[model samples]
Target chain A: MRVALHLAYNGTHFFGSQTQKETSKTVLGELENVLKKLGIEQKVVASGRTDKGVHATMQVCHIDLPPYWDDMEKLKKVLNKMLCDALHVKKIIHVKDDFHARYSAKKRSYRYIITTKQKNPFESDFVTFLEDVNLQQIQQNIGLFVGEHDFRQFMKTGSDVKSTTRIIYRAFAYQHKDYIVLYFEANGFLRSQIRLMVGALLTLTKDAIQAQLNGTKKYKIKPAPPNGLYLSKIKY
Target chain B: MRVALHLAYNGTHFFGSQTQKETSKTVLGELENVLKKLGIEQKVVASGRTDKGVHATMQVCHIDLPPYWDDMEKLKKVLNKMLCDALHVKKIIHVKDDFHARYSAKKRSYRYIITTKQKNPFESDFVTFLEDVNLQQIQQNIGLFVGEHDFRQFMKTGSDVKSTTRIIYRAFAYQHKDYIVLYFEANGFLRSQIRLMVGALLTLTKDAIQAQLNGTKKYKIKPAPPNGLYLSKIKY
Candidate 1:
């Protein structure tokens, strides 16, 4: 039986979402290890692979459990106890065998947070503090990223994907207390895409406002720092 | 002339509050290096030392600047730009030669935050998340920590403090959103004192009715996990 698990994890301790030979500290590897210990086969697939130090609020994954274990209630309890504090299973539901974690997903949502205040000792890990950001210009420039566009200029140069075109269903920036949150939703994301986009937005807000205002093709944009980006939700 | 500079630092990247022989990553060492580069000969003095993985909201420090650099406004700007991102100068005031950051401070306050919900990826570094806790019980038990008490039982085993009797002006636990913030104020604190108190409170709250009914003798407690505790505010 295939079980879909909605989960969340603190990516600070993990070496990204995918498993690596040198460092098996990824979230997927840890979940697989726990499943194996429970006498389940190591057949787990995730909705997406987040970069190192990136966090997710609702990441979906599917794992095959033995047919004999019928009680999902008991299984969830066992898995919760076995997993480390950094990883948590929010919900588990038995799904059809045809259910796929990655390919079946329709949309993904991400939120990137940046702070303008001095370093908050309390929220240091989750937010990127950019003291010199120009809030008005950044808010104005974020509208440029709302529609579908060839995002080759906003993605990492070495991304293996064949297509640079992506449909950005939504893109907006807002303030939440001491932090500014940039929301983006799309069918899929390129490697280092969100970070690069956030960086570019921040650069536009900070340095290249005049060029962006003039709609000039010749301009340079820097990506925002990585610590603030988060995978907030995934829809299937 | 010696001037006391009150500062705050996010200690996640720091080795500790004190300077070490091998690694100059301590808060004191960083400040001293910046002072040296700015041609300041004054030695920096801190109120107390904070452990690795700990943080400070308002830690007090004293440093002497050259006579030529007597302008406080310019000094603040220069120091602010010189310090690393993790370290910040909250305030820089010129004090009398006899004033000391350590000895002149009248009271110190520390706050430890623990969350009852699942771990927040955004708050991984700042707050500690415990699975389930009885807040009402913890609030009631905190009353026992107020006033002067020989906190030998709450002190860490190897703490090298000469006096265990300290006046706790405030000790209370309150809830904000999904988090419980425990605030403690005292003339001084022993090593790992706040963590130990929080640990004891957690144990007490786990069995609320019993703890509330029991007297002071039952207050012997464990140290709360270190990461959640912060040197929140220092009142001098």
Candidate 2:
């Protein structure tokens, strides 16, 4: 039986969503371990990778499990019992064998949360803090990257990607009390694309710096910390 | 120079507000170390004590410093610089030598956060999760705690205190989406009094349990986790 599971996790402690040979704290590693504990020898596939310290509220994944796992209710209860405090299995739905987690039909959305001026001890792990920002200016110009554009300058270093052009269906930044949330949705994202873009946006909010991308060179403003980024939703 | 400092801290990592001979991680231990580094060797005092795993948004304390430490602005910066992420010094105000953090205090306020059904990864460290709850009933009966009452029935074990009668100014619980916040204000609190009261309130909301009292005997409903409680304010 093929099952799709909607999951959420706090990425601060995990290396990332992908499995690594050296650590079992990654999202996939935890999930796979729970699967093994349940007496099921199946491989789990995630929709995409979330960088270390990046949270996820609605990430989707698929797995081929034993026929006994067909009972969605029982499986969720078992998984939740084992994974409650960290990773969560939000929902489970049956899917055709051909449905792929990464390639399956649609868009992905992400959010980056930023708090300004002072650090909140309670929110330190989940929000990035920046000072002296002109949030109004950033919000006004945030739509510049809404359509198709070459995001080569925004991609992180070390990944030799063949293509740099990607279409951003929607993008915006808004304020919620002291926290500013930036939202972006696209067919897919290049590694570290949103963080770099958010970093640039943050820089744009200050008078001291400007975003420089004349042709196709690397942009200033290092990618925002992964702690503030969240893979919020994946739509089919 | 007698100076009072308003402070806040994510107490998850601290032993408590007061220092202990064994652990150096108590809130006062950290504050005292920083004071020592600054060359102010006077004794430090706090408004009250908060247990391990508890948080404080507005804790108060007083320290008799050298006359040179009268520059309130500079002292706050120094203290905050030294105490960065775990603890924060919000404000520093000079006070008379007779003022005391514990005795001269007028009232203290606390907040208890409860997250129902699902465990939110971001708030796991700060909130307690309850499965079945009647928030309405909890709120309706919350006022039962207001005014003066003998909280001896709700006090924790092993604290040989003389008085059990305390005046509560306010007490209530309200829902905010999936989260419920319980508030309490009083002249002062007995060790774990608020938590035991909250625990009894939670049980009272349910159909099966009752808060029993038989002429100064122990009551039911285990104290709620310290993680969910926050010392929000203090009045001088």
Candidate 3:
């Protein structure tokens, strides 16, 4: 039986979303370990791969399991209990054998959180901190990323993708709680795409503030830390 | 000179709030060690002690330091940078020679968080989880500890408190996001008092539900996990 699951993880401890070497701790590695412990042998197929230390509120994945393991709610609880902390399979639902986790997904959304307000010790692992943030200017320039464009400038170098062009369904920066969150929904994101875009937006915001401070303006874009990036949603 | 500080700690890694054995990781031990490295020698006195795995958002303490340490903000930044994480001195303020953290004459407040909703991996260490939660019944019984009461039953056994009678200034349970929080303001609480009270309240809530369901009432009281308890505020 093929099963699709919605996963949520802190990602602070895991190496990344994809399964790499045996010694490395990855999300898929943990999943397979837990499944083996439960007497099920399977390989998991995920909708996308997130970089190291990146979190997910909603990541989709598929796995093949024994047909006898049909109680999804109970299975979810058992998996969460066995996995204990860090990585979790939040929901378990049966899927068609032909349905794939990656190819069947239509859109994905990622949110990047930056806070000028004080972040507590428990939350320090999840938010990016900055001294100055110009919200109004970020609001004005955020739409520049809404249409389809070559995001090669916003991608981490050494990543090979067939196309540098990707459609941006939505891109906006807004205040959430004490943090500024930039939400990006697109058909797909390149390697470290959302983080690089957030970095660029933060630079632009800083540049706007610098332009106000002095006559000259500057732009420097580097990817924000993976801690603040969340794979929030996937629209299939 | 005596210096008072506003302290915050995640407490997940520390053994406890007190400095015990020479090699233990504790809040005071960490503070004194950092101070020693910075060329200041002082024994700290805290307003109260927290048990293992407990957290504090606003703990008060006093310590004697080299009289030259007058710059509060810089000292605070250095301490935070040096301490790195887990435990921190949030604010550093000078106090009179006679001021003491423990002997200060005022109220203290603690909050216990209970969740029927899902707690994330990052937050699972800070909240108590239960299956069945009846909010209205718990709300109705929350004022049981509002006034002075003999809380001997609530205290963990073998604790050597001088008095079991303490004034409870306020006690109530309120909804915060997806969790129910029981807040207690008091002159002082016996060891494990707040956690035990929450446990009793939860049992009572379960009994009330059972009474409604099967027409049988029951009561069970046990100390809740230390993770869910937070020493939120101290007043002087």
Candidate 4:
């Protein structure tokens, strides 16, 4: 039987979502370890990969289970008991065998959190602290991202892809208490795309952002720190 | 010049707030290192010592400063720059020559947070997760802790104190969003007193708690984990 699991993790200590040769602390690596403990050796698939120090509130993944572990409640309880310290399985749903966690997803949403307040020790892992930011100006120009554009320059360099163009369905910013959240929804994103875009939003003017989106100009801006980015949701 | 500094720290990685003979990662150890770097060798004092894995929002400490470091703002900025990762110096204030962080303090307030929601990775360091807790029942019995009582049973064993009697000025429980915060204001606390009190509140009935407060009975409940404990404030 095939099933999809909704997962959440605080990725501060994780290397990334994908497995690595040097360590087994990656999201999939940890999940695979627990699955192996249960005598289920099937591979798990994720909807997308999040970078190191990035968090996820609603990441989806899928896996095949053997006939002996047909009880969903028992599986979830056992999985949580084993993996509750670093990762959480929010819910498990039975899905069609043909459904793929990556290819079947239509939209993905990410949120970037920035705080204007002074840096504190407890919340530093989850929020980016910036001083003297004009949130109103950023909100006014954030709509430039709400359309299809060639995002090659906005992604980390040296990546090979068939196309650099992708469709962005929505983009906006809102203030929640002392933090400002930047929300983006797109069909797909390139490697380090959202962080790079946020870096541009913080450093570039309206014309520079437009020129970069139009692929007519280039800017040298490092991507924002991954601690502030969260893979919020995915739709299938 | 005598000075009082307001400090806050996330004690997850720290052994405790006091300095240790073997290491320098304790709250005072780290602060002393930064002070020594600036050529000031005066020892720093804290209002009280918090145990391992406890957090603080407003902890007060005092030290005598050299004549060279007269500007309070610059001193705070330099201190924060050196210790921003694990500890923070929120502000610095000048005080009378006789002021003492430990001796002059009158009251301290602490908050223990418990959540009925499912366990998640992000908030485990700040909140405790419990199943099927009745906040109202705990609230009803919490008032018995107010006023003077012998809290010898609530303290950890092997702790030698001058007296086991202490005054709890206020005790109550309130709901905030998905969290239930148990607030305690006291003249002072014995070693692990608050955590053990919370443990008994969750497990013992009203009569058991009353008996424990009256020093007539003893229970063997383990102290609650320190991750959910925070020293919130100190009144001079």
How many angstroms is the interface RMSD of candidate 3?
A: 1.9
The TM-score measured for candidate 1 stands at 0.82
**For candidate 3, what is the lDDT?**
0.82
| Candidate 3 lDDT score at position B223 | 79
Higher-ranked by DockQ: 1 or 2: 2
Give per-residue CA lDDT, model 1, range A1-236, as digits (tens). 88899888877768898877787689988888898898886767999898887887889999887788788888877888888767888889988889999988889999998888877444555688776776676788777776667676666667777787778888888888877888999988888878877776766553354354334543465666556778878887
Highest DockQ, which number?
4
Q: What lDDT tens digits, residue by residue, belong to model 4 across residues B1-236?
A: 99999998888768899999998889999999999999989789999999998999999999999988999999998888887466999889999999999989999999999998989989987888887789999899889899998898989999999999999999999999999999999999999999999999899999999988887887787888898999999999
Candidate achieving higher DockQ, 3 or 4: 4
> Interface Cα RMSD for all candidates?
3.1, 1.6, 1.9, 1.3
Question: What are the clashing pairs of model 1?
Answer: A199-A223, A199-A224, B195-B224, B196-B223
Q: How do all the candidates rank in terms of DockQ, highest first?
A: 4, 2, 3, 1
Angstrom error of the Cα, residue B142, model 3: value is 6.0
Clashing pairs in 4: none
Candidate 4 wrong stretches, greater than 4 Å: A21-24, A118-122, A146-150, A157-165, A210-218, B13-15, B20-25, B36-42, B118-121, B147-152, B157-165, B176-178, B210-218
Report the candidate with higher lDDT, 1 versus 2. Answer: 2
User: Candidate 2: lDDT of B116?
Assistant: 71
Candidate with best lDDT: 4
Error of 2 at B2 (Å): 2.2
True contacts kept of 3: 0.41
Query: What CAPRI grade goes to candidate 3?
Result: acceptable
